[model samples]
Target chain A: MAVAEIKIELKKGVADPEGQNTKKALELLGFEGLRSVRSMKCFQVDIGLEGDEALKACQDMCRRLLANPVIQSYSVELK
Target chain B: MAVAEIKIELKKGVADPEGQNTKKALELLGFEGLRSVRSMKCFQVDIGLEGDEALKACQDMCRRLLANPVIQSYSVELK
Candidate 1:
């Protein structure tokens, strides 16, 4: 089996409330010198396929359902 | 400034409904691949600090807020 790791993040200029809240929380906890924070999603998929086939499958998955192309971008790493 | 990317994942044995649903969705979409999927969260934090300070701060953030110690595990990468 092979593992495909996918990382998805919001596009630039998009507002991320969770990240904003986390920054606020950090500030409340006395952590300083933070310029910004952004949040994203990750996925680890175990597939029976191998090599390039695995990556191709994952890329299709990302485009079809894992990420919203309008506001998010994603990358897949197969191992 | 430095960027600290934190990837948070559910600890082994914890149920991941989202990943399960995603697998099902992929199958429904006629993508043939066998095995399992797991989901995680990632945070890209921009900090003004440098070197060890940034990594240490991010680790502290993970311990205190970014991850639930009982059910999730996280890793921080500084760039």
Candidate 2:
């Protein structure tokens, strides 16, 4: 068995409200010097395949449902 | 500037509804041979510090607000 570690993140130039809010909250909490904050979602899935097969499956999954291709980019690593 | 890659994930035994739903949805989408799915939140923060100082700051952020000490665990990587 292998674990497909997938990460989905917004493309550059996209606005990240969640990250912005978090940064604002941190500043309010007295943590300064924060330039920017960007957020990503990660999914770890255990699959029955290994090596290239697992990686391929995960990429397909990301394209199908895990990521928004229009505004987000995804990376998959099988281990 | 340095980027602090922060990851927040549920601790062992904590139920992850998001992961469960994704797995179920994938199965419905005809994805077979899947065993399990786990989800994590990642934050990329640009800080004015570097190396150990940056790593320490991110840890402090996680302790103060980014992570829920009770049910979630966090990791910080400086790059």
Candidate 3:
């Protein structure tokens, strides 16, 4: 079997409201010296196959549905 | 400075609608051999501290805000 770990995150300069909110909340909760916080999405897909074929399938899945290429970027690691 | 990577994921037996939906969509799009899909939240936080102190702060953050103790589990890696 092949397992793919995909991480989808906003592109640089993209506004991340959830991240901003989290930072604010942390500050309010008295967490100190916080520089920044970024929040993103993660997906792990287990495929009943192996090798490049599994990698290719995961990339296609990301392009089609897992990410919005216009505002987000994604990386896939296969194991 | 310290960088903490936090990953929050649904515990086993927890319902994952997003993962389920992604799996179904992949199947509909004709991607084969998909065994399972799991989705999660990733947070990268930069703190103005280092070492064990930073790690402890991150663990506190996770317990206080980043994750829910009931259905989700979180792990933090600090560097």
lDDT of 3 at B28: 96
Instruction: Report the C-alpha lDDT of model 1 over A10-60, residue by residue, as the tens digit.
Output: 998999999999999999999998889898999999978999988888898
Query: Mind listing the fnat for each candidate?
Result: 0.94, 0.94, 0.94
Candidate 2 local lDDT, residue A43: 94
Model 2: clashing residue pairs?
none
Name the 10 consecutive residues with the lowest summed lDDT in model 2 chain B.
B47-56
Q: Model 1, B1-79: lDDT tens per residue?
A: 7899999999999999999998898899987765898999999999888889898999999999889999999999988
Ranking by DockQ: 3, 2, 1
lDDT of 2 by residue, A1-79 (tens): 8998899999998888999999999899888899998989999999899899889889999999999998999999877
Better of 1 and 2 by DockQ: 2
Judged by lDDT relative to the true structure, which candidate is superior, 1 or 2? 2
* 2 versus 3: better DockQ goes to: 3
The alpha-carbon deviation from the true structure for residue A9 of candidate 3, after best TM-score superposition, in angstroms, is 0.1
Which window of 10 residues has the lowest lDDT sum in candidate 3 chain A? A49-58
* Best-fitting candidate, scored by DockQ: 3
TM-score of each: 0.93, 0.95, 0.95
lDDT tens string, model 2, B1-79? 7999999999999999999999999999888999999999999999888899899989999999999999999999888
* Model 3: docking quality category: high
